[model samples]
Target: MKINRNFDNLVPSYLFAEIASRTAAYVKAHPDNRLIRMGIGDVTLPLPPIAVEALRRGADELGVKETFKGYPEYEGYDFVREAVAGYYRSFGVTVAADEVFISDGAKSDTGNIGDIFGADNTVLVTDPVYPVYVDANIMAGRKIVYAPCLKENDFLAMPDKSLSPDMIYLCSPNNPTGAAYSAEQLRAWVDYANEHDAVILYDAAYEAFITDGSPRSIFAIEGARTCAIEFCSLSKTAGFTGTRCGYTVIPKELVRDGHSLRDLWYRRQATKFNGVSYPVQCAAAAVFSEEGLRQVHENLAYYQENARVISAALDEMGIYYTGGKNSPYIWLECPNGLGSWEFFDLLLNEAQVVGTPGEGFGAQGEGYLRLTSFNSRENTVEAVQRIKKLLSSSV
Candidate 1:
């Protein structure tokens, strides 16, 4: 039996794995040096208290006969789905509870969503994207196209009408680069998708960090219901990265190739997935509650402050960058024309700080590096100080 030959096409080493390997080697040799990691986008905050209490309460119910839950609905329970819907409503976007599918996280759903589509479909993604989008499609042996996200466009790739793709992947407050799309910009994409009869897979995992009314959900655009399926996660929103809960919104109105994409996804989930745990769903629902929102927002604010500090340092250094205002990432150009990995090594060797090399994301990311604001405030401050000292002296 032949294995899927497509697997051979993927890079031998994952981006983060390579980062970890190099960092590990450095630490192994220099045991006394303290390394401050601003590399991975993993959140450092604890789950909100309300969510913890809800999770505990749900777990307790499992002990009693009357309240015990055996299995969850594949589409997620009505209450949690409603909570997700309410979240959209809070941002002035309307989403039906029936349209939401609870899942492990955005990363899983984004990768798995390709299962419902045919392998013949061409996938269009922004260069310098979250690796999952590209790798998943590659695994399916789909023809992949890259839309370059360059500095001229502030790292937001707009659609070109000339080429048509069956599936499109977009991320706002984008991973790696951290650039968010404006409403007008999203409208352009929505119109393009509808015009081309393509499905846009929009990732809104960092929507909680959007402070400036930048259309948190693609559904906020008028034509998006016909063309966009949005994936979001509570990982960053409520510090649920370890807890693993997220949702996918497929509009019931989105019917493609004479099939309802929403129904197709429901069928896909029912067959391959058992559903998220009842306790996790309980905790997820709590994230939308008043107190829960307040608490999570406090944690989000801390990260935002970290972004501010990093951005301020970059500004003082007269460095060109994007993100940090509406995102937890700072995508800065490599100093002195250094390549992505070159800068990554410099930061690690001199400053004892770690960041992701932008080239790992995609070809367009070659001369950049991605730094995250997911570290502690004290650590963030200290790390930036180290970076400032190193860059100032080197220059």
Candidate 2:
């Protein structure tokens, strides 16, 4: 009957909650100000036309008694899973259909996957990490260690042989920082995890945004299948944020303490989850179709262009930043020595622009800020111009 007291250790507010609170307050005070939000990585584009058509067709099938479906398979529909497998192959990575488990989204999978491991296992996460990685382990009362992602390392935390943690969480095209790890960098981690008998929870939610040569999957590195479980979402990939369909890849080769982790995950889902709806899975499968891919990339390019506008503005302002080339985020240091929240307030008050304060992410994020390219192109262009004008005048 006792509640998990470990929850007491978590911060009082989730990062986005605090940001929303402040934004609401600002809007109330400056009711006439037209605020442009370049925060919260939520996609602004509509779902791809092909996916929309697929969803409609799937729904139509359900209306007919012959094609009606009860609860879906816990792992996902075979067509969706197989489509995901084929999608991986497009990037030169091998993924079997059975290895893929459909879920609500990567956020849910990243937080819930910890359930498979023992509570006694130590967790290693990067500083300035996506908060879910840190908060989830804390809820389980596990000892958590951080690998500092300082500027010296280009914000990519490398493996350290001196430490041996049972579980490691990694995000590429990382949230908050927008830095991605190269295949060589990921290879080092795969080797480290295998040698130490640890497991890596790799989040590849933004992989579709990566146009550079960085790997689209961790399995692109050899030995990763033995030590890594990858989580991916179509939320950012194909604008399925609201529809909520994503997948997890658990290689059959990953076994720890004589237990097959893949089998354990399958059991976990079968027990506690009813699986994504048939129609949503149908739409997700279409994301792998040729026409679906073509439409999805067109939306991605629009966001990429927004990122370019923001980053180019930063360049003109001589602001040091990363991302916006292969990522939809622009992570920049607060200008004029302003602290994270200080810059947040200044930007909102001066330019009517809203961004997430980096301090909310973690200690290493204190003097930074995150701007997203998820808004409309018009809004993004206007936001950058306003930001440039404000900063230029101040300078």
Candidate 3:
């Protein structure tokens, strides 16, 4: 009859939920208003042709008993695992097929991976991080402490060598803030985790969206395999938002108390998950194919253009913002001294557009706002135009 106490301390469902509810109410009352949303980071593109064909082929295989795969090898299809390993190698990061654990989504893996370690472990996480990282540790009853990732830090959290935590969570091309860590900054974290015998949970889900030369994978840093686990997802990369396919890289070299993390994650997946559907795995594998990679890049290029459009608009008006150069998100300074939510409301009421309020992310996110470049090209251009008008009028 007792519910977990951590549930009591947890904040309400994400900020997007409230935004949806508010927008829904307004639409119900004023059906004439056309709401152009730049809030949720979900991709609005279709799966590429190569991936689509792969999915269809997979479905055909399922139709024939000769190829109908039942209860996939808990680790996932070997073809897919090999493809992932190839990806790491191509990027100058070494990983083995056995080190890759396929999952339904990064959101789920980030939460379920907690089962591997004891609850007493200290979790050092960043403030204003992807909520899943922080919330999961608390749910597991772990000791959670946050290292501030404020504007002063350029939102790239660093290691506190003086206080080593058992586990650390880091996200690059960060959600909400859109800040990507430099190579040196990432190496410092890798060294710290290795020195302290700690693990760094590196979320590089947005790597495919990175346009400029940036370390797309944490494994780019030396000694990362000794101290880090990397998470990547296809949702943003190839428009799989609803398709839901992601992978976690558990290096064979990483160990704690003489137990292998790679082996542990394998066991965890075997017990709890039936790999992604046969069709999904096949589709994901095809993503590495020459044609698949080509088609996917096309979609990526389109979204990156949207980022440029939004960022350029902000720049022309002399508004300060970060991202667009390397990621699909643009973090803008809310006008004047308005609180994030206050600015959110102002945009919705005056401009008929909606953006995410950074304050809803965490305490450090106050006075900031987030806008995603995931809308249709036409809509994205229109949204930028409307925002510029609102800004000029307000100023």
Off by more than 4 A, model 2: none
Error of 1 at 109 (Å): 0.6
Worst 10 residues of 1 by lDDT: 171-180
Q: Across residues 240-265, which tens digit of lDDT does each residue of candidate 3 receive?
A: 88988999998888999889988888
Query: Model 3's lDDT to the true fold?
Result: 0.86
Q: Return the TM-score for candidate 3, rounded to 2 decimals.
A: 0.97
For residues 15-39, write the lDDT of model 2, one tens digit per residue. 8898899899999998999999997
Best lDDT goes to which candidate?
1
- Candidate 3 residue runs with Cα over 4 Å from true position: none
- For model 3, where is the 10-residue window of minimal lDDT? 7-16
Q: Per-prediction count of colliding residue pairs?
A: 0, 0, 0
Q: For residues 275-368, write the lDDT of model 1, one tens digit per residue.
A: 9999999999998998899999999999999999999999999999999988999999999999999999999999999999999999999999
lDDT to native, each model: 0.95, 0.93, 0.86
TM-score against native, each model: 0.99, 0.99, 0.97
